[model samples]
Target: MNASTTQAYEPESHADQNSKNIIESIIHGLDTFRKFSRLYAFMGHVAGSFFSSLLAVDNLSQLNPTFFNGYLQYIVPHFFMHLYVVGLNQLADLEIDKINKPYLPLASGEFSLTNGIIIVASFLFLSFGAAWMIGSIPSFWGLLASFVLMTAYSVNLPFLRWKKSTILTVMSHVIGMTMSFNIAAFMHMKTFVLKNATSYPRSLFLVTVVMPIFYAVVATAKDLPDIEGDKAAGIKTLAVRLGSKKVFWFCVSLLQIAYGAAILIGASSPILWSKLFTVSAHALMALILWNRANSTDLSSNISLQSFYMFIFKVRVAIK
Candidate 1:
């Protein structure tokens, strides 16, 4: 080919290569976002937030495109905030995660410390910016509180690192995630989509009462399998302070109590179908939790991890 013809081909080839690079970069970015998040944890938050919001939605006719878009307006921000929460822990607990959760992007060596930091900061920006754009006081405060609490829970700063205390850790999750996922989502939907006066629904009351117990269990039970890492890191999680067996049973019993409370709460519902379904569903869940706890072999790390994941899964399946 002539020089001019070769030059023409060079531009096209360069263009194709540039397009490929752009596509690959985008694919990598998306994959990193996924890897940065824990699937069960993400689903649990998403399900809880969406369910709480729906509880506040009174009118059947309101479940329209506009209402869902409004839901997304808040949910997307919460999603980013969750990423920040989880990622910050991974960043602070890199060595601990390497011991307990080696497959995580940062722990696995697939990502650098810088990569983790950037991913975390990017999510923080997204979450904060989105909440600001939405201009909802409840959403803003909820996100801010979640960010602060989770940051304290994970970050290894002086006078911080709330994960070092069992009470602080449990309280952080009980208040932090519940406020971010349930209360914020509920208020946003009630005031934004429904455009109604703020009043507590029975559903809201049930979740508020039950979720604190559930999160307490989650905070403590999560340490059961990570006892070694937590111990090494000097994180005084319940499993580290209390023996695995004790902490394990403690979490199970706590969850059972929450379930029992839920059942009683359900029975008081004035809606007939809601009362029956809620009561029966919670009863079944309580049984299942007990059954699974009995079968799990706490001495085995693999078994404990599996059981731990099941507990997290249950939170997602809720409602």
Candidate 2:
């Protein structure tokens, strides 16, 4: 071919190659999103925000058009915050996850360490920026608490890895989740009534107290599945300190306590139908959890993971 002809073909080839690269990048991004379980995080924030809003208003009527707008405002920032936290945890635990959770994007080589870092940093920026735009006290506190807790849980800088300590791990999850709940509640109040935001209700306080026990169960049960990785990493998780069997029973006991408390609280309700339904529900849940606990295979990590998800189901029921 002549020089002019060759040059013309070269430009076309370059354009095709660039287009292919762009398509590949988009596909890889989607795969990374799937591996990171972003959908579950999104749904979780939705449910948490909804429940918190319910607690704040204490009536179904308050869930009007404005409630949804406020919800979107709250969830947008919280969603990015959740992403930031999860990404940071994955980045910090890449090696450990390679052993325990090889399917993760970072551990599986679907996303490079640099890619993960960029994703995390971007999410962190977006989380804070969205929170600032919301401009509510609850939004500010939620963002701040999430930053502090996630930093303590994941960031290894200055060795603040709270995951290495069982108590610290549980406390971090409890406090972080509580802050998340209250953030939602505050967002609802700010949206509806800026001047006189509702004070923290007694019911929410009780929820904060009881829910942490379940959070502790989830925290420890999660470790039961990753015992090998945790042990190798010199992480003193509760499941590492106590045998998996013991940890399993410990979680079961916590569930029982939580359900028992729910039953007692339900029994004292003034409304007869509410009392019967709540008490019956808790009783049934406790029995079902006990039965499942009995049949669960403590030796299998998958089974333990399933049980952990079951705890989440029970938590939703309680809510």
By lDDT, the best candidate is 1
Cα lDDT of candidate 2 equals: 0.80
Model 2 lDDT tens row, 1-319: 6998999899999999999999999998788797785465446556665776666665677678766777777778888888898899999999999999999999999889999999999999999898787776677687778789868998777769989888888888878877785555555455543334467765576577677777677767878899999988998888899899998998899989998988888788888998999899989999999999999998899998888777777777677
lDDT of 2 at 176: 81
What lDDT score is found at residue 236 in candidate 1? Answer: 72
Candidate 2: where is the Cα deviation over 4 Å?
1-29, 183-195
User: What Cα-based lDDT does every candidate model obtain?
Assistant: 0.86, 0.80
For model 2, state the Cα shift of residue 32 in Å. Answer: 2.6
In angstroms, the error of model 1 at 317 is 3.8
lDDT of 1 by residue, 1-319 (tens): 6998999899999999999999999998778667778757878888888898888878889889977898888888888998888889999999999999887889988889998899889999999999898887788888998998999988888988998888888888899878987998888888876788999977788889888888888888888889888888787777877789998998899988989898899899889998999989988888898999999998998899899889877676556
What's the count of clashing pairs in each model shown?
Answer: 0, 0
Candidate 1 structure lDDT: 0.86
